[model samples]
Target: MKKLLKVLSILIFISAAAFTIQFYFNKTHPKIQVELKDNALSCNLKYSGLEGSVDFTKDEKNNYYIAYKDRIQVIGKNGKSCDIMKDPVLDIHSIDYSKDNLYYSSGDKIYRYNLKQGKNTVLLKNIPNYGDYKDSLLRINGDCIYISIGSATNSAVVGDDNKWVKENFYAHDVTPEDITLGGINFGKYRRGAFQSYNTRSLKGQIVPKHFPGNASVITYDINNGNSETFAWGIRNINGMDFTSTNKLICSVGGMENRGSRPVVGDTDYIYEIKKGIWYGWPDYSGGDPVISPKFKSVKGSPLQFVLDNHPSTNPPAPLYQHKNVGTLGSIAVDSSGNLKSKDCIFFYDNSDNMIYSSRGAGSPLAEIELGKNSIISSMKICDESLMILDEKEGYLYSIKRGKVNAGTEIGRNIYLYLLLTVILSIILILKNQNS
Candidate 1:
């Protein structure tokens, strides 16, 4: 009986020791599979407290000029910093550098700042406001600047307009044709006092006979002072980049309100934009047309049509599904111009409050979780490393690709093996004592 009890105790001890050793190893092991390079450039957050969007431009000298809100900050190669312009007239949103000057935009006005003289010249002004213009995500493609304009309203207009019309007098079941075009026009009334307030509210209220909302891609010519809509029907796209195939890829946001529901499962889209092509907005989201009792529609209404309504005419699907992950901020392409584990798009996931990398091809590769206080505003590829801007701290973080440190990995493995051996020895001694 005594011998049997000793054997039982030894077996129990071995099992417990093995579990403990395994648990400790699991906790310490680095889960990241890809290696990161050691010698990489990193930047500390030099400035803070700027509202609005920010962008960076690199000069031939390799100096980085950062444009934020209303100022331009130049960071020297030696990590020295200087604000070239202070209390500037324009509210700068995006900036780019040419050979001798820096170009930026405030509203529809584009300005060029001479790096040597610090003089500001308006390159273009009073560029038409087409409701959904987001200056920060503006792109200077070839000879023109491409800006996205989103819809002005939550959804398409619906219902009758007579203020005096008794609620009961209006038949709840009005025919679709009777109310389709003559709904209550909310146009500029929704556009309140402030410009941002007006834009975020008013622009998409009335459906223009030709272009629905003023939402469009306005292309501005830097050499010739002319601008026009390159494409239309985008609700509120924040990210745009060109693929290796030279196809203009954009991340398009979805409609705000559908029926009485406030954006439940609307799927945002990534489109390979073609000239003059209209992506369905205010009409459909994620191949599903929005239906509302308030709005009347004709037979060919996007809502009335099913996914199979026009098999060949389906709206482009999103490369990935972020059902309610909130807004997708920026997208970058890899060397091959494809989105893969290496060629991935890094986006700020507001839902998870983290930076997630989707390898434009397969599953998500990695995630860098941030604290509650940290908010990532923008991301850019700087040489071999990836730089992310933390808006809250005004800090820039650089990430590089390299192998796991040999010393660190080997040390971890040694510790794990030693722990396992010690546990096994303890069990063996217990067993021998029982025998």
Candidate 2:
């Protein structure tokens, strides 16, 4: 028994030592490789080990500024990182830079960080922050900042799909325009549209619109410090950018299968953001009624329109539609003319880790695969290179104009830590049984 205990102690010590070394190595040198080619565009690994990075933007001098959940940093062209803001906000989702200011969104607030003065000011606040889709995305155009706020509930009817209701009981989806309830309730709770899970609504109930509403896009004029709803009724826009011609483009996430009004076979969309337009939600997807047989789940009843009368039953269709793309993410328009087109568009799909580019809406070209186990959390075009952030692996890759090359690996496999852990667990179990 003494010898057995001795052996176990040695094994445990060795395992701890190995784990420490590997953890340090992974932090210092992350693994990265690339072998992506799509018609004269060659993707390459630029930077790795971007811990906690969700979004990044480039400044006028072409320096990279990265947003990490609570803080932001600037990576100089010399490859050195300098902290710009430390623990200033929570849940940082998107970031943009203009003139001497760094603009970013976190929680229910948008902030502006003056670089020269080293001061951070809240530009907008009290944005709808509840529900599964609270993170907001922002893009700056001239003196205006366009912000996209996601819905408080899936399909506007709060149900079991909402996990935040236990904390914020009154949290529910709000509209940007006055809407009349369709006299429909969802689930046993009998919750009505735009009402809390425990609340009920009357048939033909008039729900007033509120500023800075959920599931809508609003514009903030930097000059006047005023915000106005740019568009409404859009479900969730994961990414948005402006084309060279100054047209706003967005990647809209489709309805999921877990909501009270479950919708299946719904297609994601690429849209040109138009002012005051109702890009259908809860009723229409891709400009088609949810009551259509295509959206019905096999094990569930047919889907119904959550709203009786939509602002427009026939909303404008998306510029492009993607079926089974799986949670569309960050989008970018090539304003630099790198792809030799007027405004080449690129968007990422988190489900498959594929980046698809198209000359226009209908001409989606072959996708560029970045390898396995990659979750592209954010993407942008900077300095004629497409910068992709792989949040799962803490890697940042750049796709530029180059010759196609085969995939290559550098550094050790980080998963070896997991293997060591499993082995240690087995040894402990065996020792306990023998004792």
Candidate 3:
């Protein structure tokens, strides 16, 4: 009986020892936490107030020039500020400068101001009426411009009076002229004329024209006095830039009326624009099919439509996607060559009020938060500094990269030390027990 009891005690001890060893191994495996370099510079928003879109240019002397809605401001390397344009301009969408002059866009007009003479000239006018809405301009090389025209109405079904119209009205099959049957505005409206579709054509026979409020990119010519459609079917595209490879890139908004809780994870995209390519609007957004009953597939089945006629063998997806994040204004490239090997695209997120850097080869990278300030318009690289346009306060902010904070490094080191300590404690406990 004494020998049997001894054997039982040995077995119990071994089981406990084995459990301790396994726990220590799991605890000691190091976990890596991501850290970002802190932004060095901060903003002083006292000078300008409630500004709109902005653009930056460097003079021959390498001084920075910023054009804001209602004013043209210039900042020197020494942080000196000047009111370059004494008079105000309206809806200044974008600005670009050459060695001797500055060019800007306001609504449907493009203007050039001579720096030497301080005189402004209307280079192009009456390009197109945006129609009870203001448009944003993007410059494409020289003598060409891109503009985004957004949809005018909120989301609603064709012939329905609800706010926010879906992009694919054909799937709904109710022409813009068709009247709603049971809604609040029922029995008093015509067939098919939904809020987004043009009232002039509702037979479903004509190619749908551009949505009055849907965002579109228009290419305008200054030398030849002509303009053409560069791309269309965008829903309020605010951020636009070009990649290092000269591909036109844009950040667009997602479907607005899908749900009241802001449609979590509906998928907003960053697209590389190609000529004559229609991003699925009214039918799809973010590679997902928007279903409606109007289009025929099979009886008593949901009608589905895709961007392409057939399942795309090679559809271009977003270089990056931010679910439920609202992107405002424009993206800035690191033109100073500081991050030559990294992705050149730096976009500001309006939803989180952050600045995110994309890895050049189309990989998901880390996002850096820009504190609490809201940047509404654009960003420009000046020398080694990043100048952000703050639309609400009408100021240009200069931001620089600085040393990694001591707290961040210390936190990482402590985490490592804790894991090591836990492992050593377990080993010591086992050794004592064995003795």
Query: Which lDDT value does model 2 have at 428?
Result: 72
lDDT of candidate 2 over 1-435, digit per residue (tens): 766667677777767777777668656654455445556776556667676788988888868888889888788888898888788537788999899898999999999999899998998999997777899999999999999999887678888778888998888998888888877776667767788876777888899989889899999998899999999888888889889878999999888777666677887888998998988887888888888776766354357666767789788888888866346888888887886466788888767667888776466765577668787878887788778888777778777776533432223433565576768767776877677
The best-first sequence of candidates by lDDT reads 2, 1, 3
Residue-by-residue lDDT tens digits, candidate 1, 1-435: 676566567667766776776566455432322222223322223334433437766777879877778788888888778889876556666677775778777765777789889798886664433232335356666677776655433343321231212432321111111112212223333321112221222323332233212445667677786766676655666667665455666766765433221344465556667776655554556555555443344332233321122212455555775545246666555535222344466666655566666655666544566556666666666565566666655555555555435644654576566577667766766776866
What TM-score fits each model?
Answer: 0.62, 0.83, 0.61
Off by over 4 Å in 3: 1-55, 76-80, 86-89, 126-133, 140-143, 154-201, 207-214, 222-225, 258-265, 292-315, 335-337, 360-363, 392-435
lDDT, candidate 3, at 66: 68
* Higher-ranked by TM-score: 1 or 3: 1
Note the Cα lDDT for every prediction shown.
0.53, 0.80, 0.52
| Residue 397, candidate 1: C-alpha displacement in angstroms | 1.4
Ranking by TM-score: 2, 1, 3
Q: Give candidate 2's root-mean-square deviation (CA, Å).
A: 10.0
Query: Which portions of model 2 miss their true places by more than 4 Å?
Result: 1-31, 297-301, 361-363, 403-435
RMSD of each candidate relative to the true structure:
12.2, 10.0, 15.2
Q: Where does model 1 exceed 4 Å of error?
A: 1-53, 127-136, 156-213, 258-263, 292-313, 336-343, 403-435
Against the hidden true structure, what lDDT does model 1 obtain? 0.53
